[model samples]
Target: MRALLEAAGVPMAVARSGLWRPIHPAHVLGIERALRQWGQSMAALGAVAAVRYPERAAVIDENGTTSYGELDRRVERIAAGLHADHKIVAGSKVAILCRNHRGFLEATLAASRVGAEVLFVNTEFAPPQLAAVLERHAPDLLVHDAEFAVPAGIPAVPSDLAALVASDASAAPKPESPGHITILTSGTTGTPKGAPRVPTAMGLAGLMASALGRCGLRSGDPMVIAPPLFHGLGLLTSMMAFFLGSPLVLARKFDAEAVLDQVEEHRVGVIVAVPVMLRRLLEVGPRDLPSLRVVLSGASALGASLASEFIERFGPVLCDAYGSSEVGIATIASSADLIAAPGTVGRPCLGSSVRILDDDGRPVPVGETGRIFVSSGLVFGGYSDGSSKAVVDRRMSTGDMGHLDQAGRLFIDGREDDMIVSGGENVYPVEVEECLARHPAVAEAAVVGVPDEDFGQRLVGYVVLRSPATPDELIAHVRGELARYKTPREIVVVDEFPRNATGKVLRTKFGS
Candidate 1:
């Protein structure tokens, strides 16, 4: 598959950047040796980076910068410690619950090095929720931050980078095969489900090519990852940085001004964050962050108003990606595409196919809203509990309702389950929310359907305001932009919206 893609000019995307730089004979031998020792997991990728760019900065955290050489040595020792002290071995499940930083990367790479299945646990999980996850997965070991309280009866390891590095154990023996990576869903609707991933060589290559082409990320550039490492968007970008030998500038906690400070201080080139982070950065006021070339937003809806407002303030650096844990990054919209087609999520990535299908499993016409289905190598096989999304024509449903323009750009209307029926009229809350967001006073808005006696289900909006605006005025504002039926019946003004770790609004928590 890599050969086929390379033959068809897909390789040009990665090759144009120095990612395809020729490996020295010694470095090639080192990579080969490391791959044999660590399998083909993230550990091998880190080892290759260390051999090729030993002196290059691999991670910049609160403790300061750590070069690739130092990171590699630390990872080896950590892997050795986990194996020697904790008996973490091949097929062992290693749950990682930590914020974004060098420790998160260190724990992840070290676990992979020891051939353990890495389960990225959400840092925002409540104690009960965390216990439930641990009980279900029953991981062999849990590596977490010092700040977090672990569940009872789980063998745990601290995610302290210095402590792990200080260990003097030798490296663990190579496993028979590479281990898996499980990323849990945001669980906004209910209990979080694990989406396990084992990337094939072809799939990784295709995804890398697509991301590099669309995101304009080059090798060796410093990148600021502001999102939580446990989330898909953050994890993917961090892995991409490791793959490209790019220095990752990480913040333990996301502060909008701190992100800008990091970008300015490190002369960073790429910024990986979710939509909420982007909004926060904009709220921090404008600064001359000229070094930043790409601001990648994902993990939630990027409304037209927010996209336009961000681009207006930061130039054409915003790139919105649309995907979920079930499906890896399926679509990406560049700054120009966002400006041209406000709600578009851009075209299908390279080597991936997308189709909009109606309820009957038939393709919908261009500009007609339907279920979004994607077929890509990056898509996960199934949930950890043996459940799988329905597949049509070998394409898995993204569980999103969207339409494609004549030019093939995708526009997400809302989630399939988010649709509300009121008085014989179908309404997608996203439309109403987007309309509300356009209002000057509204900072963020979320709409959910409530049981109604007359209307069957009525729309109720919860909004966080940037300026003063009455409920009547906000309702009138939505009425002006959309049909009367699409307008929220009630607009509740709030100081802030309840958000998950990745900044996605928890609609379930609203009005409760």
Candidate 2:
């Protein structure tokens, strides 16, 4: 217990978080009070930072920078307004659908302060999708950006972040509970489902240890979060910023050039993004960011090729985070790990456990692929719709097929359903996809399995080309690297791929 707390930066700022000074006694009490009421949540993090780093810069967005003190003041008033005017109180469900900006943070923090159960809605949802989510969740109120229109008759506070902050409402009373937060899963194949969970001291402790120890992140450094705040990657990283007293930088939309500019301007020490965003940064090329020490990738698969290419250009700074919305962050692979074993996702975090289990619930030997099961302290309770993931011996299934190497490093092969048996041999599509991505002419690739009369299943490839190359030539390239059966039967070249809001390729849209 002491080790966990110490590794999580409790008791001393200099101990683990990289801050040099001591936390004042009075400020510590204030943080303690807020945390006592808010639990280990974003609301408490914001409140604690307000008292601890009052004058420190807290947020930077299109509107400009807001210090911790200023941001917290706004959060208090907005919570008060929601309580006084909107009648949103503890346990009331509130939905948020906004891009990566101050509004998203304010809405979330304010709702949390009021002890409201906050649900982060994906900003990329279409009207029908959004409407369906609202209907199912039946949140008391919807807090959304001005551009997004909600279904008729639904209560909402639309694009009034500035107004809420400016209001002179009295402070809200203390609540009975810290309240729960729901983050929707990335619905790659079907409608997104709500995964509700709250942060606990134990959960945060393990995650903090991994970030500070393995990822080399320090306290009080500026951080740029390129992904949407609604995502687990951006949301969790934003909380890390609050805990470390770092200046949090956000942009409504990802632009590679703008991200580079922010890194140089802020001398940002850390950046959090998805793999696709990292690819964009690589495409836009490198920048002189001496202060940047960590480029954290999460919320999606990071191909070995992309990981290798990124580290080669940016020095040993790329850290690949592996987890799902349900499991939170189970493991983190440092750049050194990527350099040694490019496909590895490193090891389990400080307080987490990972195991590869065969279909019969037995452990698999090292270097043998099996279903990935994880027990991160932050795992969700269940889906909002009352369905839960399959759990074996207290650990939840990650729904991914992977193997651990001799050094205890985890390497994801692909999704469990994505593995195909071709010509009596099982093949993970990621191998073919990565093989295709290695070709000089191919920029990105996605592999899908289709029914085949002779082979039972055959792989089909879809690629976005960086340079001109014939399909036959690409197939020949793959055949040279992997087994003949692992090569795609057809390579359909396309100008671009159908991706979700976070830039994940959607194989469901493709027709083989």
Candidate 3:
């Protein structure tokens, strides 16, 4: 058996070991369990890392660096404080209303340790929408930073929670498996829903390890946390970094000048930001951002022209990634992939699969447009309210429409929910928006299908003009470029677009 293994090019060490003694299956299982038990929960991971690397700076907040040891101890004490003082119990929902900061991480981990679900309220929401979330979640306890002017009944915890993490390392039971972390994701239709995910399924460790491997982020490598922790991209990416023992310098919020200063000051190597944030950064223009090695852009559909502009200014470091709350990191348009397939969302990650299907749920031929369904080990289970019946057997339709080439490169056309059928022809809003964005006068644009008697549905474009221009002139410009049917029959120029809490354009409210 050993000679046969050696003939197949098996390692000599394994062959010799097998010849000497039979390997025990139980021993392998024991090692797997040991690795798993190393730490799964955010709180537990922080605690373990704190013990393993006591001196390493775990979090760089506005105040200064907070060591892992200090962060871990703070999580414990905060958990204890919530349990003992606030009467919080297992399964109790707690609303966290704050931006990205060291306190946000501490509160999340602490709540996780006590089996409490943390409802991360979108800070951008107006008073009415915020109240709606509070009503829906019905949080047992409310915790916010000093900046939040929270109403009565929801008591504020210590904003600097790192001070309390050391009090109790042995916290109570927490659901550490699938369906623990509840993140909010709005649908193409309906209200914003809660998307729950398992730690393993979300690839909390995998994303970090992969990013670290790609970026070569070691102890000394610097990273900038540009996205807010309240969003899933920020929360999971931060957790990924924490899992792989990476150091990150946190920005209190996304600001172009501040981000540039942070990269220069900390020598930041990696940065993950949205297209809007990148647009703002580019608006400021590159002035010797010497330390940046990699930039990951996601959270919205990226324009090919915009991406090329960014690459021209900042070298070939910017990578466009694609994913949603229901599905974790789906496709990553890596730097190389961008070069090969200029506008593709790239291939699936380490253990994920993608299926592009037609309207009838059958797989479409390569190069045919279809709804993008993803199946992956990293896929989240379902929404928090259990309302999502469409997601089944680890498969989720991202509500986005796209096509995959024979080479498996995914090309997103636009959102499936936002498709407009005019004069028996289908039009994708993203395609229209992309064309509009190419216009020098158009700063931003959104296309939505409106109700129509003759054509079933008509395309109406909402635009934010950069330079002064009339709606008729914009429509005429589009008509000159696109097919007459593809051009928006009606165009309305607005100062700004109506966006959801996470900066996504809301089309349902258009013309209302």
Q: Mark the 10 consecutive residues where model 3 has the least summed lDDT.
A: 11-20
lDDT, candidate 3, 1-512, per-residue tens: 22333343433333222232443676345434423532355555565456545667788868798887777667767887777667666667777887788878878878876767777776655454456667776778667777656655555665675444444534544444411667765643435578765464235433443343333344435567787777767776776566445567886777888888888887777787876677778888657977787888776666576677788888888877677767777777766677678788777664567888877788889999988888765676667776663553457887778999878988888666665655333466776787788888999999988755335457899999889878788887777555465689888888788789999988888877
- As for TM-score, the candidate ahead, 2 or 3, is 2
lDDT of all predictions, in order shown?
0.82, 0.82, 0.68
- Score residue 435 of candidate 3 by CA lDDT: 72
Worst window of 10 by summed lDDT in candidate 1: 184-193
Ranking by lDDT: 2, 1, 3
Model 1: residues with Cα > 4 Å off, grouped in runs: 1-8, 161-163, 186-189, 419-512
Report lDDT (Cα) of residue 57, candidate 3.
78
Model 2 residue pairs with clashes = none
What are the per-residue Cα lDDT tens digits for candidate 1 across 203-259? 666567766777777888898988788888888888888877899998888888988
RMSD of 1: 10.0
Candidate 3 yields a Cα-based lDDT of 0.68
lDDT of 1 at 504: 86
How well does each candidate superpose onto the true structure, as a TM-score?
0.81, 0.81, 0.73
